[model samples]
Target: MICKHRRYLMYISQNYSYAILRPIQKYILSQGGEVCWFLEGDEVDSSYLLTQETKLKTVKEVVDWKPDAVFVPGNTVPRFIPGVKVAVFHGFDSGKRSSKRGHFNIRGCFDLYCTQGPATTKPFQYLATKYGYFDVVETGWPTLDPLFEDNASNPYVDDNDKRPVILMCSTFSQSLSCAPTLFNKVKELSEKGRWRWLVQFHPKMPLEIVEKYKSLQNDNLQFIETDNVLPLLQMADVMLCDTSSVLIMFLLLGKPVVSFRNQSPSSYLIDVVDPSKIEGSIEKALTKPLEIESAINDYSKQVHPYQDGKSSARVVVATNELIENGLTNKRRKPLNLIRNFKLRKALKYWGC
Candidate 1:
């Protein structure tokens, strides 16, 4: 008889996973579970950045394949496994005190909830706790597995580089606040010798936004967007990011990250949560973001708490446990919708 423990479905509908997901998904399958890709075909195709007809067509063909347990990128969708559905908060949620984002409400419907690592358990717990009633679990997010598998020598520096290299990542929308904040950080740091700034815009952001930065013409500045240029993250010593969840992978590299307390889609006030200061905070951090050496020494003790980097393994284990418990409980039933069909249904009804 087939082993019941070997049941999982890993789903990512966005382009963020094409490179990173392949190995992790393979590893999940190797561990006696199933992992697959199901792309959502971006909601809008204004530019042809998403046009890989061959690859898109391939994913569309296999979209219906299912598993006993499912994993989705965020609170956006629940991968409908025959037995369960799950929503994963795969990064440091930017739900600061000022901006209360209820995007995670989708978690109420999922059978399980997962986060990046132990460093995140408390912050995420707060989100679930605030609501008073919600079903949430703390399986470490799987995206960090690559760090464990990396046999490379330690690359993190003890002090800021002579010319600290900064990577600024902007989300598709609502980046106006983030851009100025990040630019201020970059401009402040660039005066130091050889300081380089590489700004990567989200694929869906406006071209005018990209053009504004490009015109700066600082010898140390370069602006790029959702291209095949994956090396930028690897080269960045510090990553300044908006609330985009993709920052998890950058942090996994042990690089320091400065997050902008993103404002509401309509609100005009810009607030910095973690640092609680404006450009001056960037001044202090560019000089000592995460206190490079201290963050390294106390990483296991304070921040990560569970820094084994086997987060993917934990996700698989927890998901399996959830499936087992769900099988025992009569109230919990599997989420039985197909991948694309869920998106279509959401668009037709919820219009998101």
Candidate 2:
């Protein structure tokens, strides 16, 4: 028979910390909470966030880990596990079958629900409530631990360089998805001799796209596809991106940015829990160009009010509470199994 309860089990919901959440994650570990990964190979840059510290054998690694509370962020299933849970709801896109493969492995998922904020998870909570009973909390953001780090005062990345670093945060613009176009854009910015561009792709993006970005081989351009997206902000002169959450993070850095309205199917931006007026409020910042900072200042304030560098700490506390409750209360069967099946099929399509 299975033990009614075990210790703490934390899994790798995503691969990297990039630069943003590293610090707060470090703080969480320091707080003496146990965390682990379903997969390994999260590269280490800063010591603040612990990576691969707890190695899990995936769902297949059942024997490898048995714990009282398990935290699943990033890629996960919503099965109703009797134990604790820390899950990040990706809003409607996740709620809707965002792909054709169908969902899978979401059974017995959360003892306590974790979302980006009250705003993002509110809709799901209503559904859960109507279904009868579900526990969800607006524990800030789970994956955004890196964004709240104290890299500098006012919680933003700034430098004294005349030529600023520009982060070209790209999304799946399949319509304009030709690698040559992205490469050319970087080359043009680099060749201008006035700016440096850092190209960071989403985890779901193809390696071939990243390879083409690397192939450009320009001195002024640095292209990276990694577990963490924080360093890109520190190195950014200005950010040009679509709807990635990293743009919200840039708000903490207090920099100017240009958001894209792409013509790609994948160009859709989720309702970022962190609000953005950056795209609209940007005034003559573009016209004057030299006034980028002021325009950046005016536009950036539109970010969601919750973007304090302390999000990771908030996450740790909320997750700990969920884990405690789950440990105390066991489930008779797995919950959210339907969602799991759909998600599994979807991951297979993505070759995950």
Candidate 3:
């Protein structure tokens, strides 16, 4: 059984975590639970905290608050915090790196991992069996809850001018990024006015590249910079991307994606190596061939099968269940002294 008025902490290290965790925050608040924001690193902007939202400024405050659970969207969380540490994840597995370095990297920081779907759940379940330290729960992803909601508004709806809206996004990894390679081609297509274009980049995207795209904004193209990309994802008809996890979110919407040099090119994506073929690929995706559509549906189900917009609720329930059952049967969490020390030094929390 879950507590009715539980206290939760939103441990934020990166700005994008705001979009990832806010849906969960709303669900917590609606359940008569209290949520506090703990802004840890410089990547997070405190100004994003709303007036109604409470912000815990110091590690001492977080300790004193004694949250029932600390919801972490980033990779690691301070073990010193007085709560069950939960890993909600920041994004999908974009196959940008090896399993050891990327999504499946278990840092021994979390007690519960609320995975998106089977694609991640199966691997995490294997790790749970091997480690016996944490629990894996397929509660979908809170960030995607709004995507499936009924009342989500599309601000770009009126601007499409009957043209197929193409959202262009890329990863920040220098080796994997297609922004620089596809810039000239994207600019040329945007100028032709054949389709509407909306371009959003990773926050870590180089300043020069962001500026170049910003300068290209016109009647045909618009460059958006926001902590939340859900609106842009919903507004666009088709997405043109690289290996960015945002493409996975777009695919979950049952939309077709055209990628440039994706790390793992599958049937679901219309991936092209040559920049010249991007336009043709986008045209093909717009047509939505039966085979590609079927593949996208199959892939989406594996990545995130939930489309009810209730993932946040499931996450809350999963945390409660873990707390109620306790971790008595599991083995001790590895003493990750180095990572813990780094977290302690970063948060300046030396408490035992």
Candidate 4:
């Protein structure tokens, strides 16, 4: 039987994911649950602001913690650990093409999935039916909680400005990378001083590309290379992205977004094939942002309907239910036997 008193919840904190998991951590603590971090490294990234006292340095330490739930923001959770391994996704499921369907692949490492919304939840539910092991809970992403709560403030913007702010974010995938393609045009646009530009890219983006953008800095252009993109999203009047989950979050605000060479373009996206068309699309989007309000509203509902800022709370509840009820069937793992063997070998080699 599950413990009835205070519950212990641990999260596996990747170097780049602390920001994405912070909201769920905050919600768990507020509800009187014990929360701690499982640091894969000897030290947590200094940017996470977590004290050394709160981290479990190894997989053995995590198992010893006797956690009731293990929350993971990224795709995988360590196997053979006690507790309901919960996958709280790192970002929106943009449905971009990747090695294994990008954000759509179910790695089978999780016992329960606290999904972003219907767009993802529905598919996982079908998977749940097929697998007959895990459970899916339609909890809006905890990362977006602050945006809907109106508690998020933009430090980047600093003051109320007359110039319209434009945020340009792109995915790191080489197949869909737009930064290299649009940098020159964007630099020209920023030079015109018609709009304020904020350029943020995926953390995995190559350093050379990041350096190239950094070299073109001007009074109107600011290049931010931080893990947190929500604050930038809040401040921007218009957003330009391609095949990145950040665009979906931008659409949550019902703003216009232009995509370059989107493989599977959606009705809500302002699609343009050529980099030269970037300026015209941005102009059109900014001049009449409300023109596509209806489509944005529809997309937002499918992605995440709850704007009440209580998604983290819902996630906590769902986690508790899974732990208390317990899985009657054995938890599932990735179907590929070779991959599972390799994972086991790696785990043993690391002595985790």
Best by TM-score: 3
Please, what are the lDDT tens digits per residue for candidate 4 over residues 176-249? 88999998899899899998999999877899999999987888999997867878888888898898888999
| Evaluation by TM-score, superior candidate among 1 and 4 | 4
Instruction: Supply the global lDDT for candidate 2.
Output: 0.49
Candidate 1 residue lDDT tens string, 138-210: 6555554444454344333225545667777876555334775455445555544355677777666677767
* Candidate 1 least-lDDT 10 residues: 262-271
Those runs of model 3 whose alpha carbons end farther than 4 Å from true positions after fitting are none
Give me candidate 3's TM-score against the actual structure: 0.97
Off by over 4 Å in 2: 1-6, 17-25, 40-52, 58-64, 78-82, 89-108, 152-161, 173-182, 263-303, 323-352
Error of 3 at 128 (Å): 0.4
Which regions of candidate 1 deviate over 4 angstroms? 1-7, 19-23, 43-64, 78-83, 96-100, 117-136, 148-163, 172-176, 180-193, 214-219, 226-234, 241-304, 325-352
Best-to-worst order by TM-score is: 3, 4, 2, 1
TM-score of each: 0.63, 0.65, 0.97, 0.90
User: What does candidate 2's lDDT look like per residue over 270-350, in tens digits?
Assistant: 111112343232332233354555544453343233556565566556656654454333334354456766755543322
The regions of model 4 sitting more than 4 angstroms off are: 1-10, 41-47, 98-100, 289-291, 328-352
lDDT of 1 at 316: 61
lDDT, model 1: 0.52
Tens-place lDDT digits, model 3, residues 1-352: 4546789999998888899999999988887889999998787888878889899999999999999999999888887888999999989999999999999999989999999999999999999998899998999999999988754456767732988899999988899999999989999999999999999999999999999999999999999888889988888889999999999999998899999999999999999999989888888988989999999999988999999999999999989888788873379998888988988987788886
Residue pairs with backbone atoms closer than 3 Å in model 3 (clashes): none
Of 1 and 3, the candidate ahead on lDDT is 3
| Candidate 3, position 44, lDDT | 84
Model 1 TM = 0.63
* Candidate of highest lDDT: 3
